[model samples]
Target: MTSNVNIDAHQHYWDPARGDYGWLTPDMPPLYRAFGPGDLAPLRTAAGVQRTVVVQAAPTVEETRYLLDLARGDDSIAGVVGWVPLDSLDAASILDELAREPKFKAVRPMLQDLPDDTWIAHAPREDAIERLIDLDLAFDALIFARHVPSLIEFVERYPNLRVVVDHGAKPPIRDGIDAGWQPWADGIAQLAKLPQKLHCKLSGLATEARKNWTEETLKPYVAHLLEHFGAARLMWGSDWPVLNMNGDYAAWHGAARNLTSHLENAEQDAIFGANARAFYRL
Candidate 1:
């Protein structure tokens, strides 16, 4: 029988009252409200996405617990990439406390929003990074182009920690895919060298492209990822409410399918589900 195990390796939900989502302010009307299971269920069904790994939209242990509570009630939500104060000395203790919930799968520190791109690879966070390996938890790098260099170093140092670069480091689609981004492209290739430890998500592109995006506009970046990371390390994700700001869930999934139509059935399946199941341990 079929079940809700077809994994969308990345997605997110947030209630403004529960966490401090500074980026999700009143200015972004589309993402300024609450997004929950009920809001996403129909879209999931339509796209044949049965399960999802809910990522953190803010940087607080409080929000992580809040998301774990939601997963406790929703089986479709197979796991969570929750948040914790990475720089805090108490990070390991906090992770130990959160591990009480089996659905807690990974930790993301909102690296993209941080002022210093190398914050994750800095000396102060080394203890916490090793603790993740000891606890059998993952490190989800929510980073941007500038942070990819640090990401490479972080993965190399802790070769055992399962590190995933969220949204392919959020490439600048709004600026048009051009030659200026050769370094980002090179960084992706560098991360790819750590095949056994690194993973990437096919998500969050829609919002980055905004009104100027098209299927053709996104193909090159998708191809770039596929060329470096290949199908086995890539996983599909809706990016949900954030996706809603630019386009609907089904539309993004459709766009993803359209972009990768050249791949065989097995490769497509890896991108859509199987790889996620293995990576997230769903």
Candidate 2:
């Protein structure tokens, strides 16, 4: 992976008017409206971000197509992590069609939203998964701590499928470390030990923590990831707009930088950008 190629590995663009974003309702003010490349361009410029990977906000194929269309006209967009109908018999064909687009770098099922925690583990989508491997696309596991064990099993089932744990499995830091750290920590530690194409994003920690969260508050969790996955397998992401719920893009980016200050410059660079570029093939 190349160094200093700064990228925001995870973020999203959604227009609530599309009516496809079920979770993004009017109650979530400040973020209930549309967010697009125009809104993010200044943030990226201020942070010196050369490019970004736009992950899907809605679970619909139409939303995925919407993101791909957004990427096509936006130079700062490095690639996209879109959704797939994993249960469909035409899953392979769908992936094949999406892969034909240059910026379609990965697929992410909203695993956390699904009722079954072990869906990925036992899902009858081997053909689609195998096709993903053949196409060199990655998997973005949007999960929580409860979903980690199942994710581990899924990764074990297909050791070669590139997988990244978005938001460090979303540890319950808002409840404080002592309250729920052990379960998330233990599960994540096990995930890191897997001998496969696995990685984790150092993003969304702020939103998961108390609204008044600081760098010190996030240190232990970030340290655990760095200790286990190392800089090479961990990537930085803004998790923007949703980040507006607790903090802004600059604030999150600054906190991540400070949290990783102890690392060597090169290692920091890898966590900040190169690892993401390599993982997403951006």
Candidate 3:
């Protein structure tokens, strides 16, 4: 019973009939299956999540349009961080088209597989990120710890872009070791100096820890980012369907509450929803 109105900032919805999630396969049940707003509503209600910011799961503009259409019809979905080909010659035009839709709040490029140091250095993609900045679209940085230095460079290069570090830069929780993250954490600390930066979806720590993670187990990672970014620079995100890979929505929320139990009510409120509302203009 936290009284703060919760906003699940990092959930996703997809339809197999609309497009194929090549990422989904027979090995991954539950998540490998289709999920739409309807599947999410009950979970959110039960977890006391009043609003949500739907994020892109697929790498297609059609997926963005589909999520935007869902957000249009669903008040509970407060905003959407959709996808577009950032390298496309008409990237600005595509972003302009998405901007016309009220719920289209941000965009993300799936950069997890790219090499840590040189991925963003790729000319066309760098230009694309620059375009997003010009358009006032927030970029959700989705990379592993190895990419931290490069991400730091990207942030410095685009000071105007509102960058959200997804999953606390997705620390290595599975191995129960964070020493690998010290350099990454230091890099984030440097990036935090930027006025517009923030972090998201405190939900993945369990998977990263890949142990029987309790609040104590997640404290080092959560507390590290919370300290660096402070409440104003932090936001809550369910990372929903992916969170399903670790546990259900309620379970993730419980873990988050436990980890932040020491914070004052207002601070908790900021991480839970208020920051997301203001960040996305939801």
Please report the candidate that would top lDDT against the real structure.
2
lDDT computed for candidate 1: 0.82
Q: Model 2 off-target regions past 4 Å?
A: none
Write model 1 residue lDDT over 126-236, tens digit each, in one string.
Answer: 778778888789878887777877877777788899988888878888777674356678878888887455889988888778584688878888989999888888888
Q: The CA-based lDDT of model 2 is what?
A: 0.91
Residue 194 in model 2: shift from native, Å?
0.3
lDDT of each: 0.82, 0.91, 0.76
- Top candidate by TM-score: 2
- By TM-score, how accurate is candidate 3? 0.90
lDDT digits (tens) for residues 12-48 of candidate 2: 9999999999899889898999999999999988998
Model 3 whole-model lDDT (C-alpha atoms):
0.76
Candidate 3 residue 245 Cα shift, in angstroms, is 1.5
Which segments of model 3 are wrong by more than 4 Å?
1-4, 115-117, 124-131, 178-181
* lDDT, residue 260, model 1: 83
lDDT tens readout by residue for model 3, 41-151: 888898788999888888888889988888888888888998888767877788889999988889987778544355654534666677677766787878776776677
Candidate order (lDDT): 2, 1, 3
